[model samples]
Target chain A: MYLVADINVEICAAKSCKLCTQYCPEANTILYSDEMGKDQGFKYGSAYVAVDRCKGCAQCVWVCDNMAKNNAIKMIMIDQLPKAALTDNITYGEKSTTAVLASPVVG
Target chain B: MSLDYVKFSNGFEKFMPKEYRDMVEHGPFGKKVSVSQVGSFKEVLEEHPMCAGCAMTLFIRLAMVAFPNPEDTITVGTAGCGRLAISQAAIPFVYGNYGDQNGVASGLSRGLRLRFGDKPKDVVVMAGDGGTADIGFQQVLHSWFRKERFTTIMLDNEVYGNTGGQESGMTNRGAVLKMAPLGKKFEKMDMVQMAKVAGCAYVATVVPNNPRRVESVIKKAVLIAREVGSTYIQAYTSCNIEYAIPTDKVMEDAKAVENDRYQFTEYVSEEAKQYLTERYGYKEFLAKPAAAIPNKA
Candidate 1:
């Protein structure tokens, strides 16, 4: 499990209030990307989660939902994700995807 | 070991978790950082399982930032909501039995003092209202009366938040809750005044509405307790869940409560005042009106 940032509704107040980035226990798991916000046409930068580094603590989700009141981040179960959905704008999922694909489920 | 132990080596850096690496490199462990730099730097607190919009969690975060020497400081807490976030911090923490934080801290501070021998290992006792005022009242008072060289901080959320919204001694009079359905018959214990009378060199009552003020008061208390007698800080960290306060209105409620009764107040003994003024040049604390003088025969 990992976290994904919804750039549309998660209009992050990146520099002004980076609560998720500051409070996340793991380092470099959450980063403020000016380019990501610019690509999404947001006036301010937004935060993105590094899927490979994220421990799925859901701390960022709590901070975003309660403290920031933005409700922009959500936890995604890697097994439930469709194969094609991995190529979407949820950046930094390639590593997790390859690892998951390398080990096929033997039910 | 020296502070170098907290830093990572060049060759084995990759083997270390990025959390520890960031804490060593960008955290406020040994460096001088303020609350304003919170977002720009790495915080000592990690992801906690406390309730959403928990005021106690927020205060714990600020207290971590206020530690003058995080690398050398050891926090002691009891069974309460405050410990959930406190134990998550990167610093070493001792979670004592119910309401035994003051007892544990007395021994821990003395042991650290003997081991370090003026190296400055700050031992802080952080507990909830029930832990400090009700369950551990005797230990807390004796620790102050004995002049144990440690700082005691009470996270006053008014009620027993962790035990399902029961009433505590720190709960305000007439505040209805589970155990006190008819409302508390007595007024809240005046811990600040108690601390002053019990021989605490410094005492302060604060709320978490202003992060900077919280940091400053905590830093001062910890620093004073290092050399002076014991110090105390009672922070009003409201329990939004038990109190039925809306998450968004948490800060507003704190502000209202502070204005109504728990206004920010600080009391420093003459010795601590002289020490602070001489060492840190904090003369402004002395400018405040002194406590009323007692009658002498």
Candidate 2:
């Protein structure tokens, strides 16, 4: 339902806290193994989050502080996270499963 | 809006300009203007060199009292001198609007004690009602316990004068003003009580009914803190502007404060008289002329 990056950042963007591996609605994302990067002269992971098929839902970003701060992952087309854009004081559950809203036509 | 005072939030919000010109850049002190001329009046500071105004005077005085070497000493407060700590006469300083200056003063004093290590008494904290009473109360309380040898001045005008007339923790009972239009119903807090219960080593309350007394109380507070260490002074100041009262009548209100002169009954120990006389020189301190803001610093 949603895409998560396979890599992680070494530092959280705003408070500079520890980084968690890529979190997605499906919870398939994991750490890229390398904490320290030679290019940036610090510990960091690549940001490869694909939020296109995200079903306009946000679960992965809640767990990732870097994503919240720098917005490394953004909606490609449909609807961007308007509510999340205004506030960032939330946390995510361990399971990053994408939640599907029950559309009236579904049942 | 017809009051003789103006809000001190800088150049941006230009809600009231005429009041700003008369009260701030050109002040009520040392000026001779009739009540009718408030709207058209512009402050033409007399030929004599001025010490800016209250916040400026407060900051400058703090530097003289705290930093001995003229090189050290930082100040902190909110709005006017509190927020924008401007340097005058080569003195290093800091300022901010209402909040705990305790942390800033504590850090600076501790730093001076640790790095300079030799000078822990070089920082002065000057705060207003909103900062000292609302936010910075915790910090100042902790600093009192920390026993750092820095002095803190709580300028009590009762309301949060800088923030568009909000009710502050210090607002007096029945004092009808903005924000608390029905008049502040809650009991006004006694900061001296806070200091006493929290183990503040020294405590004093001085008013400008007699400016000499104010300077004396201030000087004595600084001296005692410097000598024995750790103290606070709640300087009871009246904000004629904040209350939308005429500035010309401020002196009358100041004199009236003598009637309500702080009753240090609760916290004052048996040795209060000796302490007042020896420390603040309270009796003599009270003798200074009403208009005399001692230019000691």
Give per-candidate clash totals: 0, 14
> What does the lDDT read for residue A102 in candidate 2?
23
True contacts kept of each: 0.03, 0.00
Per-residue CA lDDT of model 1 for B1-297, tens digit only, reads 247767777788889865566667666666787765554466677766777667787788888888888888899999998888899888889999997889999999999888889888899999999999999999999999999999999999999999888899999899998767999989999898889899999899998876778988998899899999899999999998789986556676778899999899998888888888888888776677888899896
Best by TM-score: 1
lDDT per residue for candidate 2 within A1-107, as digits (tens), equals 33222223334322222222212211112212112232445543232222222232233343343333543333333232222110011111221211122221112
TM-score of chain B of each: 0.93, 0.64
- Taking the tens digit of each residue's C-alpha lDDT, what string does model 2 give over B259-285? 675533223333444565685555742
**Residue B77 in candidate 2, Cα distance off native in Å:** 2.0
Runs of candidate 1 with Cα error greater than 4 angstroms are A1-107, B9-11, B286-297
What does DockQ give for each predicted structure? Answer: 0.08, 0.01
Docking class of 1: incorrect
